[model samples]
Target chain A: MTSLGRGASVALTDLEKSYDRVAAVAGVSLDIRSGEFLTLLGPSGSGKTTTLMMIAGFETPTAGDIAIDGTSVVGMPPYRRNIGMVFQNYALFPHLTVEENIGFPLKQRGMPKPERAKLVGEALELVHLPGYGGRYPRQLSGGQQQRVALARAIVFKPRLLLMDEPLGALDKQLRENLQLEMRRLHADLGITFIYVTHDQEEALTMSDRIAVMNDGLVAQVGSPEDLYDRPSSRFVAAFIGESNFLPATVRGMEDDVVVAECEGAIVRAICPGRPASGDRVLLTTRPERLRFTDGAWSSSAPQNRMNVTVTEAVFAGERCRYMLQAADGTAMVLKEPSSAAIRRRAVGERTEIAWSVADTILV
Target chain B: MNLVQAIAGRVLPTTVVGLILLFLIFPIVVVMVVSFSSATYLTFPPPAFDLRWYKAYFGNEDWLRPTWLSIWVAAAVVILSTLLGTLAALGIARLPPALRVVASGLILSPLIVPVIVVAIGIYYAFSRYGLVGTPVALVLAHTCLAVPFVVTSVSASLSGIDPRLQQASLSLGATPIGTFFQVTLPLIRPGVLVGALFAFITSFDELVVSLFLSGSGAVTLPRRMWDDLRFAIDPTIAAVSTLTIVLTVALMGCAHLLRKRAT
Candidate 1:
């Protein structure tokens, strides 16, 4: 296989796509670095796929511009874009053999037959489907077909690759294995990859940076850790993983932390932006971060504590989950690792939960 | 009472279906048997088996001329209709839903209209253009009848294909024209082949439109066969009928096999 070299940087400036007065992708502007695996992650109808399609040149934007490596590609046809794309359904030509399908693009480029065959063989090996070139697409299993599709897309060594939910139809076990393989391929090729998927875990696992989209716009774009640890919005916090929100009244700001009062108890949370005193805000934290104050080894660090009654308790295999109601009737959840040495809290039990100020984020 | 109902449910449908099958096939069987008769005229229960009528059909130039005309006309119709019909189907597939329904209905109107009505219209229209009694007239009229079948067959095949295949081809750097030849055409080939076969059979067996157009210059096999039956009753007519039946059935069988392979 030819070395792909460094990938191209892509920039979308106020890109928009609408049909009959209804917008499918509304004003999305994002900058993707060269050789980075950027994932457009969202739920269905969030315009992630539409945004990817526009970048691939399959869809013409209603307004704004798309630039690849500082060159405008907005009006270019898909065939002239020189970009590689893989669809969710593994859109292999049903009549063509695996080798023919992979060599199709090279043939269109007027590559000699012998040279095309060589690249096709190397691509098949890269996708781990060596020596299966003579078979038709219908003869292969679903996983095998997807591998062929990936091989076909990358066989020509396109600098930039676009994938739209490529692993969506596979079973969970196969999807996980392919996900690791894709990540390995990305590292090996040093090519920029723009992946679109609604699976949050897939995005978090594979992306160098993720753009979480909602309602046809980017809600937040950051590294997975940044989005999970310090989400800038309530939607980002709730969408990334499980979160507990506590309504609080901001007293004042102290440096980067906001001092707030919640459930008649004083609390401090790290805020991304400054909020005025008396501002009502929601303080969010992960369920696993809250600990029972009665336990020994409680740290001497400043902790935000809340007094609550356990409304529900269930002993999961890996952890004990407690649903609690604060004195002001605000519902919250706390999870503790399952261990025989730790006492389990029962329903109706009153307890004080403590978490460090660093774990709480004011959104 | 339950046993009677059960027997009636099973026996009634079986008897009715068997009777319908016999009703449909009995005439063809009689014609086929008479074609092999040693008699001088058309008659069932042959006194002896012989190939005299077949030999007569092969020897006579009057009969051979019309047969060749029919074959050539059908071939021309197949070529013209398949090209037009395949293009029509492709255009229809890309149409918006509401307009698509209207366009398809218009294309298929030839099938829904009465044959005699279409024949009369074609005859009057072609006479004004001095196309009557010409091979071009027969081909044009037959193409009108055959195009609907081609459109229907090709449309069925087009629907079975995944539209994303074309997009994938385009994104892989193949031009639109290249994508159609490499991906779209190969995938929808079975439908096109079936449509061509239908077009050929439609022209070969057509009698009503041929009657209007095949005056004296272009006398098709069906037109000559009608003349033979009306003027002279002979076992030769039975022989031609058997041959026509075999050709039509073989063509239909080919179409059926193509459709099966496509699925």
Candidate 2:
């Protein structure tokens, strides 16, 4: 069913988008591999959806070009572009039944009845809503209607699939179920999937690689693990998953590691790009990265120690989260498995939190 | 929350509504009562029952011809106004917000203007083009007067439909004209029917424009009624008026059914 035979990689070269002289996407260039689940993750007005719409051929770019299979598609109409789109509202034709709506694209291409019905049947089965083609859109629930819309979009098997918050309208349980179904569909269909959303967890869950956008520019593009472990920018570090920010000044550098001073607390981190001495930097670390200990720090251990007081200890089912404060009031968040031993370190207790230099990514 | 208190509260408003309804329907009841009067003049009640006036109206050949012509002219008006007004409403619905208001105002402006003004203008225009004594002049004059009402009803109903229905069709790969016929026309069917009914009734019941534009050789039913009223308050004219009232009530009933279908 793959028209391009596993689909050609999408590439945008110096793509710029502007509306009424206000730059929405600027000099943004990304090469998305074939059969990859790529999600453009950003907050509203951050140019993520604009980039998707531009790729879908709905909106014209003020400058630059987008190409599939190395062929530029500038000034191409949406219908002629052969790109499938799933909108946020699930814009289904209310007057048409499920069968007719799914068969619409096939009918447009002048496919014969037997062939069109056969294809529509297959599309319905793909979304697991078989034998319900006679129903109208309004008769179905939101999730059912969304599935029909999805079936309609992919019924013709377009070369590239563009989804703009397609599952954002569904409830949590249904969204999660559809997310897994969508991943399987992507694998089976073998088409390049370009999804856009502002939800960080959604970006991390279904995406093979995420392009985290900020201020009309791509802040970082990497796999979920790469983004979480080694974010290249301050925005990425803060945007994906939670992170504790420490205002610090670089004090020393040794073997890809740098020692920094956060208020009176000294912290060690891995800095991207060589840094000069006394440079002001943002020290970033995840909640799960820190370990609580009662002993003194080892001299040879590639870790730093900060004396902290657990101001708030919140229980989160599987994990216990401690909101700690340093002597100088620099806040630290730490998460640990809710073991009996961990719970014993109750709130308003003083302790030492330690983490290896590799756990931190200096921004 | 008291039972009798709440019941009384609702009944008082209903009582007021019933009073208003009586005030509005009294004139039509009086007209019907006087149409059957044995006396030659209109009164609250007849001294004796008679069918002579009804028989006289059916026997008059002059009234019969004009009434038949008026039926076909009103039908022509319905057909013309439905097509033109529906298309105009659809066109205006697609216009940008600022232009939509302007287009709607232009289309419905005739309703608020004086009908006599349109009658004089159409009379001179039809006479200048040698169409004054013909049926075409009556059709044209009636169509012009009825179109604004059609436009008003159509635009109101058209605004109630979902605009995304059109977008969904276009995305489904249907062309613009195909989408309009297959999707938009079906969704706006009730509006078109209502507009047509308004056009037909307005043209059929019209007297002012027909009086000005209609020549002596081409009198409509209302024109014939006017001529009959000049010499005497005859029972035959009252019979004709009663028939007209019945026809209107039936037409309005159909309009009500159409509105229900829309819902």
Candidate 3:
């Protein structure tokens, strides 16, 4: 119940790691705030795990510096860094009991036997594994072993914790439960947590800020809502969640929004930078944002509308997903909440889909 | 045809296995029976049974000296070989894949090379250093033969453990050396123990190398038995063989128990 160590802010300056001249983490620079739960979300081979290893001192950076609380840890050994790390495979010591494993770091620091035991007990309780300390790691199930690994990592009260896909080996159901528990633990401990995972949904559910990585570089870093609602690049948009990308040409600027012409229709979208008129661009929007114009819903704000033919429709339990083809032969998807009040459109039906201009973004 | 094939599949292997076991065990049974013979000459199916040969083996100073020498040399080999072999296995495990193959094959070459060839080379090498007749010579030579077994046993268990456990220990604030002692060493202890037992047995039962390096001053039990067998038809050699077989089996059982406890 007591708070863990105070969080330490980390600053990675131009961190780079390469193997045989091929860069795994190519020019990554980010400032992580204290007490933040930041998830590195990316596909495999995106260098997310490699970056985490650099911070943990397992992999030496080819260039750049890693500073924790304003102190450089470039050449410092992992032991001297005083950081906590949880491996994906739950690397628990098979020779030691749970209590001994949790007490390992404390014992290394020369904490007295009695004090170490007390801290180990508190750690087990923190991870909801009380009274299981006497058992060996092999005696416990996979989830329990991971909990013990977590307890061991935090029992030393490390200022910064790095987890490399800690919940990766667990089943989906257990992974979901542990994700919430990890979030609660992050809140309670108030220590910095840098997690690496390829699962976007897990990152979205847990991270305060998610760094979406692609091709060995960070494409975008922002809050989960910021990433989902306004992705900065095509890679981020496609990696984070499903998006309907439409090719368009810039016509002119309307105040701050860019007016783009798509499929012979005028579409207005928000762009962070100004584009010259007649420049080609791509626009992206969420499926759920698109609605059939035949509905009674109407907004006073200006909207973007497109006519499309339903190529495929699936009546999902909670939502109806319809695949549509635009007039220019571009594919798009529309999702609507299933309700008896709204009639479901059959395949091959032509309909006009409307969305607010605010929901659309030019990437 | 199906019934005939099934009977052959089961009965053929059972009969072959039974014959092979009997062939392997017959010499040991013969020696055990001969150890209890009252006949002064080495003879099987003795007219009467007694313990004179066992008494002669236990009471003779020449036999006792060699037995003690063998035991002490084996103990020393176990200590030296286990330490060296465990370190070698650890080094091999850390090597890159291409280099690891070369290093592992080099370490295990003694196992594949003929013992007589190794003995001749060691004899000439140790004789040049004037160590051919000393206990140190036997200990050193036996350690070379014993080390390969230790390396093999320890390597099997070393490869079985998760390398991440050491990384985890280091990340948790344990120094690299501390991690080895606290985590790595304990996990591979069963393998080390098994290796030590193998080293002991290898040195204890060694004859070809002892025949080459073990002069009169450092004659091991196997060398003394060989000398007795070539010079005289003594029943005392039978008693010694029986005792050696018992010691080897008991040590092997100890190794098996340690392995079981570890798992």
Return whichever of 1 and 2 wins on DockQ: 1
**Which clashing pairs does model 3 show?**
none
> Which 10 consecutive residues of model 2 chain A have the lowest summed lDDT?
A1-10
Report the C-alpha lDDT of model 1 over A1-363, residue by residue, as the tens digit.
233348988989998899897988889999998899999999999999999988988889999899988889988999988888999899999999999999999999999999999999999999999999999999999999999999999988898999999999999999999999999999999999999998889999999999999988899999999998999899999989889999999999889999999999999999989899999999999999999987443787768888899999999999999999998999998999999999988899998889999999998
In the range B185-206, model 3's lDDT, one tens digit per residue, is 9999999999999999999999
Query: Model 3: how far is A31 from its true place, Å?
Result: 0.5
The Cα RMSD across the true interface for model 1 is 0.6
Q: What range of 10 consecutive residues in model 1 chain A has the weakest lDDT sum?
A: A1-10
lDDT of 2 by residue, A11-82 (tens): 988899987789999878999988889999998999999998788776788999899877898887665666
Instruction: Kindly provide the TM-score of model 1 when superposed on the true structure, using C-alpha atoms.
Output: 0.97
- After superposition, candidate 1 runs with Cα above 4 Å error: A1-5, A295-297
Extract clashing residue pairs from model 1.
none
| Each model's iRMS | 0.6, 2.4, 0.5
Can you list the residue pairs that collide in candidate 2?
A: none
Question: How does residue B226 of candidate 2 score in lDDT?
Answer: 90
* Highest DockQ against the true fold, candidate: 3
